[model samples]
Target: MKRLRRVDRTQFQKLTYPHLEFLYNMALKYCGNTYDAEDVLQETMYRAYRNFHQLRDEAKCKPWLFAILRTTFLREQRSLKKRPLLDDGSGYLKHVVDQDRKSLGALLEEKMDKANVQQLLEMMPEKHKSPLILYYMEDMTYREIADLLDIPIGTVMSRLARAKKQMKKNLLKKLGMHKKKRNFSIISVFLPGGGL
Candidate 1:
């Protein structure tokens, strides 16, 4: 059996270290807590270190690292499914709505804060959320999202459409607004610069 060559420590660090913060942020989006995000980041770094030799292009490092981190997060989630339930569902932007429908209209008049936006984001399933995160939040192209998710461009488009519709429906329902088939204006207006 052919053994892999030892990686140069400095070389790996130089290439991969710059993206730790991005990876952690992405991890936070996926894991929803600092502790779990840290864990995912550590695991992602480990996997990247181990597979650094496989990287053929330096420009693709960020995307490749993101893919590793995403895979690690998914594996952790799947493993948790086999275990007992311990989550209280209280961590990571968990919001409890108690306002009546009448007051909810007032909320629609105002801008959405980060927590409310994040709460809406958390309500969606991962398969749907991933595309949104990649396309909108990360500003990646649909082709790039499809490549990262290993899905077809058409599937990415469909999932993005469905995800947007679901978010609009959820937001309108939550805020007690009329459920019009309009664009999710808040997300488009607030997401990029409003610091989601």
Candidate 2:
């Protein structure tokens, strides 16, 4: 590993450390578990440290960190492709409670549950989920999201639109509220009260 000089380390810390919480939350959403989120965060930090010299603009640090986090998550997912799903023993009860929570009509509280929201994200396709998470969780602009994901701005908008649609569908289905196909503006699932 390349060692960071004192000056470089300080500058890197100044630019990056403040965003650790943001990174951690994003990682948690991406990994869907604390353990894997921690692993992803560690890997992201190590990679950032090693490649700190490559950063061209300090103002772009947040988006740069996001890029690293997103790539690291995609890599982790690829590596775990063959891993079998282990039953966590939280059987139908968990689903029942989740449904109840949704039906309670407190949109903010129901959406604020991290685990529940993360579970919903995990059910989404990665393409849609990426933009959905970036836009909703990070408050990133479509341009920024496009750059981070290496896709066009239009693509980001479309993915977000589709992501929102798919999330509403999935959420309604989970809450046993899906009756017919209609355009419902249920964006609260992605945005709790204001942000994640």
Candidate 3:
């Protein structure tokens, strides 16, 4: 077996250490607990260090690390019979509902909390949920998500569009504000003294 040299080890650490926090948080999102998350992260680092020479681009380090974490988490999940579902504490909720992202309608600034958003993510199908978690929670771009998930760019776009729609519809229903009519307006989300 080819052993990693000292310089290679240092280079690997330099490239991969900066993303430790991101990897851990994402691991938590996937595993839903500290123990499994730690296991997956440790394995990811182990695999990355062993295969550091295979990484072609330093600029793609984040996506590469993300992909490793995902695969490692999946392997860990398979070994365990049962696991709790994930919850994210990311600030994506603030950006999604209340921010200038006019593609999705505006809602009560305080209505959409992390729990509500995380619940919505939990309810989504994994294929769709993965993109949203990567994009909103991790602040990764569509391209990065596509690369990490090994899907086409168009697929990433479509999945995110559908995920957002699902989130909106579910939130509206949960908030007791679902309307059967077409052309849902941004102002429809705003309610006085009531939050999502």
Enumerate residue pairs that collide in model 1. Answer: none
Measured with C-alpha atoms, the lDDT of residue 144 in candidate 1 is 96
TM-score preference between candidates 1 and 3, better one: 1
How high is the CA lDDT of each candidate model? 0.72, 0.75, 0.70
Extract clashing residue pairs from model 2: none
Root-mean-square deviation of Cα positions for candidate 1 versus the true structure, in angstroms: 18.0
TM-score of each: 0.43, 0.44, 0.41
lDDT of 1 by residue, 1-196 (tens): 1232434667788889999889988897676446788999999999998898899999999999999999999999998766654545675442232222122212322356667767887899999888876776566788999899899999998997787677766676777764655555554422322112
Where model 2 places Cα greater than 4 Å from the true spot, the runs are 1-4, 82-196
- Candidate no. 3 TM-score: 0.41
- On residues 1-196, what C-alpha lDDT tens digit does candidate 2 reach at each position? 2454878889989999999999999997776446778999999999999999999999999999999999998998886665555555874222222321232223434345766777778899999988887776666778999999999999998998787677777777776668955544454433433221
Ranking by lDDT: 2, 1, 3
Instruction: Encode model 3's per-residue lDDT on 1-196: one tens digit a residue.
Output: 2464877977988999999999998987676446667889999999998888889999999999999889888787675535434445763322222232222211322336656666766788999888866775566787898899999999998998777777767766775768755445532343211222
lDDT of 2: 0.75
